[model samples]
Target: MTDTTALSQTETVQSKADVVQVTALTGSIGAAISGVRLTNINDDQFVAIRTAFHEYCMLVFRDQFLSVEEHVAFTARWGEFGFNKMSPQLDDYPMVLPLSNRGKSKAVTENWHYDSTFMTEPPAITTLSARDIPVGGDTMWSNQYLAYETLSPGLKAMLAGVRAEFTGTRLAKLYGLDQVPRCLHPVVRTHPETGRKALYIGKPGDTVPRFEGMTPTESEPLLRFLYEHSAQPDHIYRHQWRNGDLVMWDNRCTMHYAVHDYGNEMRELHRVTISGDRPV
Candidate 1:
């Protein structure tokens, strides 16, 4: 099939057990599934949805036109949500976080990094729904599992006991550290649920002084190398969002960046995070 026509297949509605699994991109960590809607999901249907999310690490539901209240209600089924401290649009629905690069608010994630990893306890899962889609505004998510597993075994072994601080303010400064976050996380993190090892290195400006006992100069190059390699093209999936498209991802195993090529066109999205006990 032609590249453009590949994902053009009409999504078919079906029963929960008969859900269709269609790849959004050739080798990405996410899948666009058909046959279900989140707004009025049943227990069994949600189970299947959660299963798909765990296996794929990310899941996208298309053409699901839902109201703000309905979207927030649906995401709450996954877990408790958080408010967006920097965005004022979340004023109405305190539980939902608004991600907008419009007249009123700036985009929350314009760089590559995991969501809220700077916090002592980061979000476990995040569900984002598009309210408006402007040209050139896309979101890209990277599979950290694949990124970590692809490294040479020797390198993996070297990173076994390593750790680094992940500060949010520093990451925001990549465009300039003018206004950045301050917090720390391990350089190598163990997934709370999956128990798999992942490289949790740089996020824009997160400075890596050292890994365990290494010197700053000694560790900088290696950390930088991994940070660059982890977001390779092969492990990435760039989604061109549409209004009503809902994308959910496991923050424990993924990093995302927003594409801001759409200069003036307004784009808005809402995110609800699922709380986890803690990072393992």
Candidate 2:
């Protein structure tokens, strides 16, 4: 007689490898997922994908070049789609926002940041679907959970109950917006799902003005350290995007940098963010 218990375990492991294969792209943050298509995935596969997204903080699905409509549809499964204030939305699909390098002197995403932090409720999961790819417009993501974990416990204790100011000054200037938007968020935010703490420092002197009323002089040294430390090379994974890649990251626990070494060539991408609650 077949040992059904051992047989079931073997089948389960095989099924997982068959359904989706997630390979870590870096020791710290991003993972590449194969054997599944975003446009054509079942609920069980999606659950596995979401689990992988949270575990790795970012998931890169290669060759998913989904249509604009299809991209919006797949992302909507996560939650309500947030409006992207930086660009004009597609006429048919309001959620489809473009991130093209067609008319800009510099890309706003060159620095590391959490998306839409100026809002009280910034989006949680941000998915970017590659439209057009230049040779060197790679993006990098860092794990903020590791950033906070690796910090000295003394510093962690000191940051308790600390809040920082987040602004859109640089991005607003890049887009020629009239007024910059800003908000206050905890310095160390706890993830709602995983219960892990993540350092929420923004680009110093840019988005993060100062630790709430502590003055620039008081906050500069520590804020700069946190910012610099959170983005250490060992804490990051850089993605050299392919023509059909679809990458998604958790904004609550990751900071991503968009590198623009490709000049004057067409580099386009579409992004949709799922609304997240206020950081506790």
Candidate 3:
């Protein structure tokens, strides 16, 4: 039986050559990775995966089917575990949070925004392992680097010294919390590892109520425009999730929106976020 199991594992690795194969999903943001399993990735494969992640900002690994322990282990390769006080975790695995449609009154993630931006030190990376998936429940991600790069020189100059106030208003409301978590981050944040700048704006009155030192009314119009501009079709990649898929994104450089079209269909995924430095 042990020999047979060993043979099976060898055959599985041999079939895929144990090499990482990355294919760009779009011209802008995401990549689809194949050939290496998340359960047992080698040093070379990890280097290649990390390189692709830096270039693409998001990655999709199909047929991962990772267990809670496997998910946490894979996420730790990126960094320390980032806390999400708003989401409940599994009793056995504190770092793994189950994202389900069960008893959810509304989908707070339907808007394009970074994960846990209200935190002083927000998550740098977030990975979701699909447990159950329903048709029509695709998630979309926008390229924030392109969002900043495409702006006019004058607008860029004006925003160079600006900071925005990010609040956990939607998440707070969803979780029925009285106090909202909030923080101030640069409007255009520089990536610590890549040294690239990304627009860090969120939807007005949703996650970002206003720019620092500015009233909500004064910040609304420009904030709305920037939010809309960042989410243009040319700058986005939409992922149609499949069961057993593990998708990870750089929360520092991308904004994601979860589509709730699969209503009452019981879609669920396990999430693990990696902590990052405070946005500069």
Better of 1 and 2 by TM-score: 2
Tens-place lDDT per residue, model 1, 100-153, is 665324544666778776667777888888998888788898888878877887
Error of 3 at 14 (Å): 16
lDDT tens digits by residue: candidate 3, 1-280: 2111100111111223466778888878888888888999987788888988888899999998998889889999998898776788999888888988853358888889998888999989999999999888899999898899888889999999899999998888878999998999999999999999999988889789999999999999999999999899988999999999999999989999998887689898999999899999
Candidate-wise lDDT, in order: 0.71, 0.85, 0.87
| Candidate with best lDDT | 3
> Runs in model 1 with CA error above 4 Å?
1-24, 84-89, 102-108, 170-181, 207-216
The worst-scoring run of ten residues by lDDT in candidate 1 lies at 1-10
| Number of colliding residue pairs in model 3 | 0
Listed in order, each prediction's TM-score against the native is 0.83, 0.92, 0.92
Candidate 3 local Cα displacement, residue 225, angstroms: 0.9
Clashes of each: 9, 0, 0
- lDDT string, candidate 2, 21-93, tens digits: 7777776777787888788888778877787777788988999889998899899999999987687888888
Q: Which sections of candidate 3 miss by over 4 Å?
A: 1-18, 102-105
